[model samples]
Target chain A: MMTDYRLTSLAKSLPDTVPFVGPETQERARSRLFDARLGANENVFGPSPTAVRAMAETQHWMYGDPESFELREALADHNGITPDMIVVGEGIDALLGYLVRIMVAPGDAVVTSDGAYPTFNYHVAGYGGVLHKVPYRYDDHEDAVALFKRAAKVDAKLVYLANPDNPMGTALSGAEIVEALEYLPDGTLLVLDEAYLECATQNIALPLPLDDPRVIRLRTFSKAYGLAGARVGYAMGAPGLIRAFEKVRNHFGMNRAAQAGALAALEDQTWLRSVQARIAASRNRIAEIARKNGLRTLPSHTNFVTIDCGSGPEFAKAVLNEIVARGVFIRMPFVAPQNRCIRISCGRPAQLDILTEVIPLALRAAELR
Target chain B: MMTDYRLTSLAKSLPDTVPFVGPETQERARSRLFDARLGANENVFGPSPTAVRAMAETQHWMYGDPESFELREALADHNGITPDMIVVGEGIDALLGYLVRIMVAPGDAVVTSDGAYPTFNYHVAGYGGVLHKVPYRYDDHEDAVALFKRAAKVDAKLVYLANPDNPMGTALSGAEIVEALEYLPDGTLLVLDEAYLECATQNIALPLPLDDPRVIRLRTFSKAYGLAGARVGYAMGAPGLIRAFEKVRNHFGMNRAAQAGALAALEDQTWLRSVQARIAASRNRIAEIARKNGLRTLPSHTNFVTIDCGSGPEFAKAVLNEIVARGVFIRMPFVAPQNRCIRISCGRPAQLDILTEVIPLALRAAELR
Candidate 1:
């Protein structure tokens, strides 16, 4: 029964589950900061020193430009698109929430892979949308075909795909994504999340039908440029969909410091390249460490590496717990099968050293148990 | 006629107007930045230097604590409440949007003063709430009693009141708000916006019923603490309503540097007091300027002063436009007859000097036109 202060029926129906548990919560609960902070896929290498300086120099008394005019212009130049095609926001998480709200109504169908970004699913649920989850193929990449088919079958309003995906650190190439877009249902808009796309640092033009109304790409300063805390992300699409976002978005939401930081970071591509190289090195190191412990790693195009624990979800959970107890913070996928592998983000050498030392120990403890 | 991607019917039905246009947009159009930035009511005194240092020192690579654990603990202590009773978000704007989303379903009623914060009314309309506007009484102050009566009559799910109000520089005391709470409908929740509360800086115990569920009070670092660009704000209320925010809020939405900056800013109460004093001085300067111009100044408890232009909104608009054209940025109330007044924020001495120079010129230009 609905009680005092009548909440929307959709709100009352939502469970009290947060999209992700912040690592700081764990730190507070344990009464100690993690010795090795590698979870949540943060770039421990940090933002460009130039960006930090620029952000720090901002007069915090002034509200940021609601239009994000300069940052969007910079990003448009960076991505070879017109400024009108880009809409910058607090983060991709927020943009996804806004997208879900605009597109989904009660019982509206949305499709995604079963083990895709939990936050996307969280937003869909929050908006009271019916979610259809397609499983991964051969325990690797998200099944694009199944996602397309499901959207068509259910007449889903939206479909979500993250290139260089999180958790599993697997991806669909841009060419593959472009081909799949043709198969999208006539009524469905595809949300192509590229938050991790810059991890490769290739600077190669990703094949995009930017003029297409059916697809929009999400990118962020969080990954390679390392401004996750600044919470700046953008969506690229046709002008119509871009303008539509202005209808529902928190227009005056940009952080003034973040706008400066993002602009500076974009200008400093040298730092991003270096961070990508470092993430690449760290990923290889993690794979090497896992291989030494008789574990196999899924090939990754992103910052993190996921190692198959060769047991079950139970074993992976025990190992993850042990690693946490050993002063390292790492996460794993939520569902079965993928849950058999623990996800570790790229870390600095000292933090990776902790991981280098702890995996085997965690494995032994889990085995003993 | 449903087209290629079905927007939520509500989204499709909404108008495309934004709540407020940023001053930056004005600057961009004019092809020059404003010489005096007084329109938004942001503190010209800026945040504590320690906060700038703390924010600048943040590792921008990591997502902020979704829990906002430390900030909440600090705020809880600061406010004499438990941490659970406070929920921090991107800003008071985002919190208000979230509150309206949770409380008002499509076609539900909401109540507010006729010329109150446009953003709140915008959010209510965004969520498809029917708004009942209670006009100002006693010539300037929002009629709190009228608002309560209208809300009860319309059975509004939500009611918004800005203490130390915006635009008109008027207020309803905490005790007055408490009395209003008693008259609220059974399911109505009052959104008590205290964005300018610290403008007083007197530390008088404003008779707030902080423990009451019927009222949720908003506080922000945007005004007195001079972190408008940082975008940090909080809601204080019953823990249940606080936790309900989790179901809809972007959990990791905070700027990491903003979180740090806020904590440091809070620790530096000396800086806050100093800024408040500056604001008071600026308020006096503005009043003096208005008096010199033969305009009446509304008694202000907030950082900005609303000056009666001694004419209708049309003359105020012409004066306001003349100010903008002269390279000073200022705003007026959007609704009538409140629009008869032009709102000016407390500025730095030089900025106020520009305002003093411009007001007479603006008045002369408006008269000539």
Candidate 2:
């Protein structure tokens, strides 16, 4: 497919397909805007008012702190770690790509679940890392033990697992992950992507020590904080591992407004709590809609629900297309068995109304197809 | 020095340095804020009120157009080129890093001036590209013919030259560049970093045809548009080279506010022209000040002026430090010959007032030292 100038063999082998289509892209393709954007797992409730005010206040400033010193200090105070333990980036997507650049040299083995976040896989493939994908468990939670075993078998340098996994909205317990670590080989770094950590149930194993040499935890203002547009994400790990980012990371990469907005977002716990409540209400409404349609909704600890549509990928695709045609944006899994389920993000009441009204129609349309 | 973890050999060899120390970092280090900031060539006039309003308007939107569809289309209309010929990134810094990643395999040759923007050199080093630096010719503008000769000598895959070159505030004509392109090797890519293009006095170059494969031009909203905090920079080249970015780019990398702000900024050429006029006035004022102090000012096509201190790097450093100590922030060239000059950004009348008040005192202080 690449014709003119030759890219590195690794880049040449990468597929043009991306993990998820942005709603704006879909809107352009459909030639009509979505009436309800409950796809892509974004919080439609939006960022905190305080975050917005902070961003507005800082728009006049020249480039935010390159070291992100103030934000890092505030985050350190909030997360109970020294500033050296964290490295902020454009987003988890950017941070993950940078990590792969550091750890996964050409031909290095990388491990993840078969139905895991495809963007992580895309990055590994982009960097010429050999991917070893283990299959998901019955509940759609990544099988951590299996991932570790595969990493050991392949002598992998990196393994990625997103807690409260995407597409399925399923999560593994901290004990289970800790148990699986026993099987992990030395020198392998575990990239625990907790993008939705805030929305998950309480006591879900957070505040991982900064000195943990083998584990790097990623968190973002994008999801539960309703700041997906800000593009602020941070990684926490041992100081040496974190500092390695300076070698290749864009020192001035962060947006000034994002730094201001994210710092304010982190400080506004009351607003976050309010969003959590709304998310809980929205999730329940989605579950009720699924039940009414004779579908089983997976118990979601995140900001979205995955409902078994009682069909295969073909039927799921039909339902998605039908809903999408009616200006209701939704998505589904990419692989077999999992593809039987469709995913919907938690939005406000108006968005839920659209889904509740359209689900039966979409299901009927799928059956007719 | 990297005790807890072993970085790749390439990362180890890369120096721990950045092109410039940002004002925010300096403020932290000094433990006292500067009264005036006229450094790093950022627009002190601030972004267009329209851009700020637009960003504030869209601050809550999750994920902008990943394709950057609307913005790209609008820019295409503005530039009289197809949208396929453009790719936007965090800033020109990130774009340079990405371009280097694609072109330079380990030990590949990359060419730039000895005293060119060090960030380009930093990117080349980080990517394990062997840097081939040609000295600046006696004339202030980059010697494109000499650069081409060096590129040919080293079989350089990439050649970087910032028109309206920084630190010296010099520029080459569009015709001179086009003439030099004839000598560019078939496989080599010319990275024409025109970060200050809008501020340059010369007749600016239009986006070349989509089939012009030998050169890729970089532009940013950070300069004349006064949106340095926005972190929006774009590259224009043949569609084939531009599309290759998808293979390794962080797909959802852009900030939504930045996308909205840059779109608004690009549309407001009236504001841009006003800024250009202000910058011109400030440059003239700076040159007059230099003459009054028996210093020589170079011909400037950019927003900043580099005044020769009629001494060496040490003397210039003293002057720069004195300026900083007296609450004005300015910089000088990092390498010799050029280091005999100090770079000062065009600021509002008040900022220039501080510079005018401080420079003489600073020079006297340096002489006494």
Candidate 3:
């Protein structure tokens, strides 16, 4: 039995658990380091030298401007949008928590693709919202139409779609999403998480109008920008919706060094391009290695490749455990069918080289099991 | 009429506002920079050289350990508690938001001193909690007895008390707080905000039992540690209450560089001592300057000194506005009596020199007004 201490009924009902355990926790439990640390999709190539310098030089004593003035100015300039349309926070995870709290009342319905980003669902649940999950399409892509249809059926106020979706590494075309957008009812908001859009060669990111109050788009510095530990993410929407964050969000969530790093990193498009090129090569190499191991790699527009283990969730999980046990960190999907695949991020050549050596051995171990 | 986007009943009921407008926002509005940055209680002496180096050398590519393993371990060791008794977050502001969310449901009762920290009240409002405010006693200090009595009477789920109280810059004795602890009801969790405790020369911080489920103490790197921009804060409490934070907190909310910098800052107590010495001398100089300007300075345990302008809130406002217009940044409290006092942070000698130059002129301007 737990001590309640008069915690809200919702909090009392929720389990004392976190959304995802970190690799460091796993490493501690295993008492070993991963030879190839690819899980969680952190960009191993790291941040731009300019950004690193910015972090060093940023005034660490003063609290960062809660307004995130300069960073927002740069982002607005780059996006050709006004600063009022942007609200930056610690990360997309933190923004999601804020958005969910502001939008979802107790028993309000929210829709998302089944086995999509679990963090969104985690937040939705924490706010006492009822969730409707639409299954992924046969190709393992998130079902855009189904999500919209479910939102309408449930009268959901919110829908979540992770572009170039996580785990599966599959994405819908921008046009495809625009078509589904017509089905969203009035007052429903689509939280489009484009965390990995930069890594994609194609700009599958929806060209949703900046003034469109129906959608909020999130971007992060953790992946292609290589500042995961800095925990910076921004949400862009209509001014009214973005401004709604002021009511509930932590005003000073932006870290000073992180903001400086993000500003410098934004200015270094050349470095971002280089990282994109490197990720493309790594993706190609990962696909090649998977082919050699007789595993089919899913077509991905994101930095990671999802290889079909050619069996079920258990087989893929065993393979994942084998890879992890051999000290190559990787993750797998949470649900059936897609769970038959294991996901690997765009590792550096050295880490990928280690991956190439161990994955086949892991497959052999999984087979033996 | 504004577009609602059908926000939650609670959110729709809430006024869209920020607790504090950042100085950068003011600078942008004025199209000018301040000569002195002494407001906001930030450590203008800046972070230690070792801390700056740590920020530079942090592993920016990786997500900070969600568990905050190294930082929490160091904090636990320093506090003579296990890591489980501590939970780190973006800042005390964020942890307060999360605590309010988890503890206070809609219509749940919470209590705090009327003119105490505004941010705590901000969070309580955002959560739709019914807040019962008790006015300060004649001493201008936060009335601990009044706060505890109000909490008991309201059957409050949460109570907030910031020692070395902000605005007034006065503090209570540890024994006095321990005496008030007797009035706290079983279901109420006392939220002890000790953000400025490290700056206090006296032992004003209560030696509350860490194992006591009735209270949680929050500390930050933003004040004496001079890492406000980093947004790193930790809450210490009974292991069970601390563990409860895992259910709702952003597990990876911490910035990588910030964590590294804080760890280094925690290790370098010599730097902390030097900063405290600087703050002490600065506080004394601020008091001396206020006396020379025909004002009285409150006895302060915090880094900032609140000067009684010997006038009402309007006169204090005039003085504050004149200082701001003259390119010197400082602030005044928002409530009466305390609002009669203008708060100035302990700036470096250069900044303090600017303050000394401006305060007399600002007072003259206030008199002219």
Choose the strongest candidate by TM-score. Answer: 3
Pairs with steric clashes in candidate 1: A90-A231
DockQ scores for all predicted structures: 0.67, 0.59, 0.74
- Give TM-scores for every candidate, taking all chains together and pairing residue i with residue i: 0.98, 0.98, 0.98
Summing lDDT over every window of 10 consecutive residues in candidate 3 chain A, give the lowest-scoring window. Answer: A1-10
Give the clashing pairs for model 3: none
Better of 2 and 3 by lDDT: 3
Q: Could you give candidate 3's per-residue lDDT for residues A104-157 as a string of tens digits?
A: 988999999888898898899998999999999988999888898889999999
Off by more than 4 A, model 3: B1-4
Tens digit of per-residue lDDT, candidate 2, span A128-198: 88999888887777899999999899988898888878867888888788888999888788899999888
Clashing pairs in 2: none
Full-model lDDT, candidate 2: 0.85
Interface RMSD (Å) of model 3?
A: 1.8
lDDT, residue A238, candidate 1: 85
Docking quality tier of candidate 2?
A: medium
Residue A348 C-alpha lDDT in model 2:
90
